[model samples]
Target: MGRTSRKRRSTLTTRMTIASAALLLGGGGLVAVNVYASAQEDPGQDAGGGTRQQAQQQGQQRQVATIDCPDVGTSLPDVPDGARGRVDGELATLDSQITEAYQRLASNRTAAAQDPNFVQNSILGPLKDKRGAVLDRIGQDIRRSGGRPPQGLDGMAPCTGRPSEQPQQPSQPPSQQPPGQPSQQPSQQPGDGSDGGAGDGAGGDTGNGNGPDASDFVDIKSVQPNVAVPRNQRAASRGTFTTACGRNENGKFNPDNVIVAPGVSNGAHHMHDYVGNQATDAFSSDDDLANGQTSCRNQGDKSTYYWPVLRLQNGKDEADVGADGGGKDQNVGEIQTPSSVTLKFDGNPTSKVVAMPRFLRIITGDAKAFTNGDANANASWSCTGFENRQLKDKYPICPQGSKVVRTFRFQSCWDGANADSANHRTHVAFEDPRTGACPGGFKAIPQLVQRIVYAVPPGPGFAVDSFPEQLHKAGTDHGDFINVFDDKLMQRVANCINRGDRCT
Candidate 1:
């Protein structure tokens, strides 16, 4: 989205400090922990005779990393066609409200330190009230459209402060892991208490002191190789269709998400690197996309492929430092252009692929996975030579001569009727993990596998842009696609896949 000519918000003069005591529940009892007043304090002996190391450890326990709220979009029932537009606008407003509240929380750390209930009474309580009013409006819209609205939406209004400890890893069965990825292992670093081991800490400061600490990166060499090729049935559509979409060299960047928040500017709250259809703003209609310019080598594919832009935390600033979806959203750093981008579509292992409907919108991962949980997370991070090992929650610290890679393998199953769903996810589904088959009643389609590589000075210095509250966690990485292909080209894609021909 283009930057609007509105008054700019004041910048936070200092980084946030956590001084409030957090209550912990342990052994069926509530325990309060002591916290220091400032993060920049020098380690010294306390009156209680605690060592410097002990004091620093206690300080780390009290840090509040970011705000955590329930995802309202994921909890909503099917919205009526007539009310879809209103419902979507309200959802985007909800996200914007969270971003604004997070900025307040981060900037007013001193006020929070003075009063224990400052965060609850001042920030979260007011946010809850705002969200409750919006929820009521959403309910009214659905009812007016002759649709039933789900109850208990107000319960999702209240948010909490998440501690700065290591993020929780998604628990998945071995069969649930990606086709060639290995099972996750505990951190090799002793006493780190992180899912992945300690990182090299090359990123220096987590962007604006919000998230993605040293624990978010791991050396790819430490991971064990465990990639296994999937076994295909005799009737499988074994072909692949590769599309040559350039690495967004034309500088098509925007923060509008047409699929999720149509007609609303800055709906994504973060910048995205768009590669395919050039006219893909939040206001782009299907007709607009059909006539838009294409970046793909073949003119027939006017499909849109975009994802959050990756940024380096090397103490630099971009042109959007003062604009929305950039520094104003607490996403400060130099936006990194990908060195290579590969968009390939593969067929299902047990079924023949069908032509994807025109205007089919698919979102691969959850942007709010850090707090909403990793149930829908589908991130895959690895190095060039260490592609056999994939990390869902950690950025890879690539070795020399290796480049950082971010991959998103989109869902392959379509619900046959809808090009999109109320929640943007119900219309598409991933294949069954063990059987390599589509879910019952869903038809198999060409699965989009996007591999984006970056040539950076390898370390823990880069992160994908995210909503301010998401804290730039690697697990929150996601991809968005809207198929705008012509009927002739789509049929050719299906034909190539079904005929077992690898065509480009």
Candidate 2:
């Protein structure tokens, strides 16, 4: 933070290439796929698991001078020593993970290995999500330390590993002689389990056990840019329209529905909590949202607000029995529960906008947040007493009377025409927090911000349940919304946004 003291950050980019490959490619398994995974611990680790590793990493960093890379100038990465070291170590560790994956292939092979989402989101998704949260925290630390965090991962490590044209079969039969490489074993074919999918588990990437190089992969997806914003700071008051949504602890429900990732079956393998409009689930029609109960003080507003459920696992809660190494891990230690959550939506600046279209579906949180080790996983955590405070850990433990919370902000800039994008994004953008204004090419729509406070009582148990794909990633914690408001109600809020008036 203090000028970073040294200049060795650039070398990390090269190293990150390996980390990124392992993370994006799916835990060392070499494919990116989202599927159900049973609880399995790293050979030697405890429940405090991922974050616990981070806390311990604090003391072991090698204080070397930063190196200079042509792309990264002389400045250190916009990260603190603690977090920088953690990511650096993880990147370096990924090389060995890939090797381990190769070793495991010698014993068993499943066809699911061919699917990228399977390993990426299931086996390794939680791992990378946890790591991404820390990386996200590192950026926050940079900002808190008075450093200007960079916007993207350019010049950071490269992750370009792509799958070969076809899954690789063992060159030698199981009984054939091969002293160096582990003996090839008969592998499992596809459709091995009841989760409902075909996976032959084709044994792929059978190299000399050194594992694939980071360069072997390709950047399959795009990364989100960082938008610097103040903590708990009020808008410039330039836009007169303002709205507040309330917190509902027991208000989480799925409605057996989903729209964001439609046909994914209920929209979530995990549960979500809702506040604003009570009945906005996947199956809810406009009438359902219009007639639903209101959590906010105003009975007139029915905007929907929802996110993942955080269940306490003091070892007795049935909600978190199998969740190991997470907040509720007993055999292992417990992970951190985010201090509090904030959910809000903002309108575009520069120009006034009318009501949002009927049945408009807006998604701001990163679906890959909890599953990928990308920059978007940079989630912020804090407490109520010092709402502006940002914690570097998974979640901060709040002092007496204050609750932990997670803040979720929706994109405020609309395309001026389309209500949604094919990907649920691109149609809208974020307003500049520094100026409270929308960037050019985007029309400022109403901004919605929701803060979820976890008022946990004094106790020894603290756990939060997450979607299975998240595998209990703290930063993967996100929310979704669908504007199912009646035409009349939608017009009222739209009018307030256009007239520069506040709505409660």
Candidate 3:
């Protein structure tokens, strides 16, 4: 199926109290609680001491900008029939253009992407920011008409929590870095047609940084499952499979390779990074990945895992706004990546998960994020658990019943042999949604689906992280993953997933 638009059911407005990104914790270690206090002990004599009293006084001294937004007046612009379709069509078209902008940025070198002025003026100004204007209009019309506005757009992020609660993540696993240092971003650029290279990380680039892992901020309880997995079902002939491929703290934003399949280099035109397995790349074999170290909770599970990189940029950065849109010296605003990204094994909301065959290539999202379906824009953006068949908004606020989730499902009907194919996709096919099992020619295996959730809300100043060149925007938010599970280990996962065991 191709990308399609749907009517809004509910949405938030654009009003916001803008604040500095620095004030937010961005997911760091909790501040240590002071246990001892003394009123007269070195009140003024100690320079190393910031007494609890002094700290509280200083906090009081700082002025906090607060905004209490009133809901828009009930009166809404009456919409003529077909107006929604026109806006939907416009949004679909802009989706393509904005994707291209991110692709162009990914194709460029890091220096060019980070050049500041050029990135803002050339890419973001003309492409990303412009696309955002259209999204803003779409959202406003939805609001005025009493329809649900799209989430993830310029003004549609949720406003339920303080932005400070959002997370800022590092590109390397938390184990490698010291307490509070971000790993050095690789200087190498993409499009090695001559620019630079994916660059060798063999010895020094273990991708270590101080920022907390993106998953740290997610309070598992905040989002609950709306889909009910069947309590019991006929077991697959093959054992079940499941793996808690924890979110990677070291995934990089490498866009030039395909992490969703083998032999299809650059199939995903956006960006993604891999972790868990030390040696995951386009050409990596299943064995190579299984032997690699894992950052997942389970030590025995050396499954290679990956997802898109999210960033947080302060609003003051001169380079935040692009093109001539903001005019001269006008600050563009704070840029934020999605608040969360997650992965889970699930079934179609109505059926039980079956075992998946080995070498199945499942593409969960609209690889193209559009119907044109050109480079795997099979994009899927949702606010809850596994209601993937019901893709609606271009971006959605994390719905109350679920977290802001993005899921990727692979084809499970494997051809029985050939771990991979030249095309990188033909080896596996989708199952029958109704039966929850693979069709005639192929047998069923565990259904693998990854759900990535984010925390950006309905207020102002949150956007996806792009190469400075792409100029932060929401459509640029995307993710992908490829599995090269060891043959025997594959059976173990199948056993785990089908046995109804929640072993994270």
Candidate 4:
């Protein structure tokens, strides 16, 4: 089903915070701890003397940003009433299936963790498989409904910890640069396309630092297209992207090539990373990155990048705005859907397509400040004794009654002045899957639109489009994932308009 617009408040606000890729660890090897800490340490280290201290300091910084949705519900606009009913019905069914599956598997987890011999191979390895199944089911629903995942739940995902705690301090520092670092010159830009390029520097040759300008942000009001019914019953007109070149031609913005790796299939392991081209390195460790399909951009290094963590610009009090307020809370983060499109698993080095779940924006919060008294002992786990401490490992495994809430870095995000700009603090987009089924050229998926704020400035000096040329281009080839213009969805749209509901 296409996205439906519900009522929202005028001052839509949210939070911005850093998101960590690994789970929060209460205790682990000092060596492992140090590795995670280096991401954000000061470059000026005192020879060998700075290692341990830097690690601890890095851990402390992690506690700064965090967010949680106490009870915030979904906010989608522009959908047919019939489509909305179908979605609600499907979601309810999925919830029941998931809840039941987890309950049945709880005992198996405890037994397997404590006694390795009792291990019976099941879905998703342990706790993660269960959750992954739920998400996968949601993705299928999108294809069945004739629309992709709605914008709000587009790129939303859960993360392990906060940035301050797990800041990415590259091993090499500025002082360690090669002798001619500054004079070495910038990397040569690829210019094979004679159609004229966007050109040099961060903002390109246009001399317009503002970047490719798009219209002011307009929230999705409804996906139900107007039906040729009684003339008097037609609804008011809404916004649409009509420019001939409105499609994203840039390599980064193109969505046609983006896809989740290992292509969706039975027994597919959600732990693979196409960036480095291998299973994630830390799966067996305390906090596993292998729980589900990791999001990746189809660009250089393919290194997992941060999903814009949302945090309130000002330290404002948390306010619970009803569903109509467009998710306005002190710590609301904005999650967006993929703006590009590509064909389903086609035959090519990277061609692939499969129904995937609708993703949601996830927010985690920092732990309380580090004090001298916090325990430093790493939690232990063994199959024989698994039931007692399974959840303690910082992975999602849990004993039947464990009540621990997973902790990770958090940032709240809501509407900023401009939601589409890359720096609209806390806005996130769907990562194009690294598996290369997407066409090489960029093209915009007309039916799909990315969610973001284009007007607000993200920080002290950064505006929403801070990194103009950096934002990805929409896809060029127009292969549809699911034809939303199909007769089935159209019929439903017409049915809703027949009722009192408004159609856009």
Candidate 5:
């Protein structure tokens, strides 16, 4: 079954039309408490009414954060070849249902505050029904294709309301700079008119009432240095291949995800900043990508590299304020273009590297890590000068004169057969964190390390675009890549790494 057999679904309609409402319940920036109700519970009575009142009196009500659902796509590993297209399309529909459900929750804050059960009866119940139907279709698709459907898929439909308590405070006061390191502030860069300052008000309501509260950011200086270098084995491939793709000066932005939702428009539900392969979109096939124009100085590399766009939380709006993936999805703010984007391929520390298949697809980090947990969370945030101090869950508060940085080191071990997988992740694996070795039966390939830098005023005033239900959480940051390098160039890349030579 070729990939082109997949049919495109109609464009995702823009359904988020809610006026901003203050969802904070208590003083000190605390959010509402989580409310779970049984079917017999009275709709008029608050599920956590007493606790809500007491917490408000004590100024410590837990915050009713975003929705949390099981990632069905990630759980299914045995989807048959003929059923992949249908499965992928249904997964995209599941995402759209969640986004629409979240919009209802955000717009009904007043009702939810009056009756805690309102969220369960009005929002979560319907969402579960919608997701259950989609999962059933997925199971049927697999069964019809001569594959046994995975068990317990229907049980994954239920989602819960997550509760957040308070912002994370620094362990200690801001520390002074180490000796020999001069104190300097981040230089102002053009793109998004953000004034250079500490951005003390960054924790305030982010134009959208949903997220990125003060709890999401921590001062980088307060964090102790946590990065450690892995030891290279005697047979390690030590060369590097750097590909210079411009910083997306052409402003190619979209909400489509070709890898996960090939035929579905607005599949990501959040805007992305594209760097290479101009023809990349939800509808592009392998052939279209192969023939696409390149942004790299070297035409041989037409690989597509992209990630969620980071935006300043300032009151200003971008051109897509009302577009499906922008404000309509609760991702409001001015999109900040990166000051620099470096695409470098590194070799394995334990063995010689091999060339990746021409169209291998890899996604690093988890876009829903806020609700899905940190098992696949791979985001790394830091400041220009303090690159040694990396943060995974919290956004970094870069000191004055320091710019923000996001880095993604993609998985380097390939399964040697399939270029992609049902979940879009199982085919590639990251080497062991401590030993730097590939898993058994896997081959080491040229690992792409993406380093992106942005010059925004230092503070929590910036956030990455995310699913509406994700609430723009920093932990959900992720990156995507598609290898479109021709055979000749791919072989050259592998040779350069094996011979320990640096090449462009």
Candidate 6:
């Protein structure tokens, strides 16, 4: 059977129960599910009988991975003027309406919770199909725009309180109001607590709504300076670094707060900011990010070590995802390391960090390309080896002397962290535990990390069969995959590539 494409929508429908009902019942209601039907032209369907149970089931089908934040500096190609304007206009209208509904929901909950007759109420039922349509429309917009900005490659939008539709209010002045009340308050009524002020939602600035601006992007350039590489920790030259994969000795996952805010402890700060970072969710180490610098102020509580950190300077004018250099770039270059480089081992503060990048190359493609670290997990390929290897291992296996390479041609579909749900590529890292280096495997590599892919011309009597299939595949060891952190050789290689000559 042919594969089925995933269905997407612009707006999402959410069911909320008034807190007053929960308080009266002495417990939360059937909040596990919310039911909403389609906006049918027929008004009679609205009155049809059905318990909340059926509606709850429909919600299950709509659950999806949380949308991620967009890549900083990643810019979408110019959209057609007409389409762009239409999308912008529609979004503004939807955003305004949703904002209003959110206010009502907040107010109703506050009032209902204080009232004695508060019954379990589902906003989704009252808000109706409009909520779902909005979510559907937004999702569709992202998909239709070639998965570019506004939607963002990561689908990272600031969503709140199950999206809603405009509410119907009484045409006449509310009877419960005080005597001599005006029909409506001025547009800027401070006393009207209708819109939950700034505190209700998280935004960039107070005036423009707290959505993501270009500045919110965590650009490599922005964070590069903060990454401190003391002379001892620096590669003898430039463009090289080391990497290690290990676990927290305490046998506890490092919370998101500790990962993003390196100086802060886990319990000291709010954890929301670090939710989408790779170090917290995938690898579980700060050394990988903060340049071999782990957040823990104390030492030897569990385990920590110095990983690799590279310093690169390239002046290539490659096209990037962003108009400004905030997104992915096609310009490729490398950083060469000095003969002697030291990585600071955080565990043994006295010891130096290990590893450096001696080679550099860059290629573009989906999983078929050796350069696709974690971007191409679903693309299929046939291998010459792997007869007895366990399916558990996620890479191809080779006999003593066999090489592997992709057989098909596919367009480059690198989505970075946006399409992380279906990724298959793995990064390489040295697994140096206190006892010894992890066997066969190095440390685990993630898509979030940076790497280099170089090309080596076929040599005389170069037997492809002599290579391991794992290394032969697009990203394996043999086929031009090298760590850019190696300063000594990679720096020269980068310069050579730029000068149109091979590194001597």
How would you encode candidate 1's per-residue C-alpha lDDT over 291-327 as one tens digit per residue? 8899999999999999999987766666666567777
Q: Is candidate 1 or candidate 5 better by lDDT?
A: 1
lDDT of 2 by residue, 1-504 (tens): 111112111110110111121222233332221111211232334665544433222211111000111111112323443444333333323322332332233122222233324333443434444445544554565566556657663333322222211112333322111111111221122221122111112321111111111112111111112224433223322233334455554334441224443312233434455677765554454555667776655565676766665554322222222222111111111222334444433444445555666556665444333223322332344556555444211344456676666665666666777654433555666565444455577765566655667776532134334432222334445556766555676566666656556654
lDDT at residue 275 of model 2 (Cα atoms): 71
| Deviation from native of the Cα of residue 102 in model 5, angstroms | 0.4
Worst 10 residues of 4 by lDDT: 471-480
lDDT agreement of model 3 with the native? 0.36
Q: All candidates' TM-scores?
A: 0.86, 0.48, 0.43, 0.20, 0.84, 0.21
Scored by Cα lDDT, where does model 6 land? 0.22
Location of the lowest summed lDDT over 10 successive residues in candidate 1: 21-30
Q: Is candidate 2 or candidate 6 better by lDDT?
A: 2
| Local accuracy by lDDT, each model | 0.75, 0.39, 0.36, 0.21, 0.73, 0.22
Q: Give me the runs in candidate 5 sitting further than 4 Å from their true place.
A: 5-63, 165-203
Over 4 Å off in model 6, which ranges?
1-486, 489-504
In model 3, what lDDT does residue 280 have?
54
Clashes of each: 1, 66, 47, 100, 7, 47
Note each model's CA RMSD in angstroms: 7.4, 21.6, 19.9, 24.4, 8.8, 26.3
lDDT of 5 by residue, 1-504 (tens): 224624344433433333322222212112232222211133544565545443332221123355778899899888999999999999999999988877776655445655657778888899999999999899999999999887899899999865542223222111111111111122112221232111123335444445676657778887666676457889999899999889998788889899998988889999998888987888888888888898888899999999999988666666666677877787777788899999999898889999999899999888987677655667678899998877766678889999999988788899999989999988988776666788888999998989999999977678999998777777789999999888899889999998899999
Error of 6 at 329 (Å): 31
Report the lDDT tens digits of candidate 3 across residue range 1-504.
111222223221222335433232221211111001122243453576555554443222111101111111111123323344345344444534444443343333232312434434555556645555666776676666566653444642111101111112223222211111112121111211121111111111001111111211222233223232223335433233345554554433233333332333332333344554555554455555545566555565555555544433332322222221110111133322334444455433223343444334343322222111112223344554435222211234343455455555555565565444433444555554334455455555555555556665431223333322122222233444445555566556655655556544
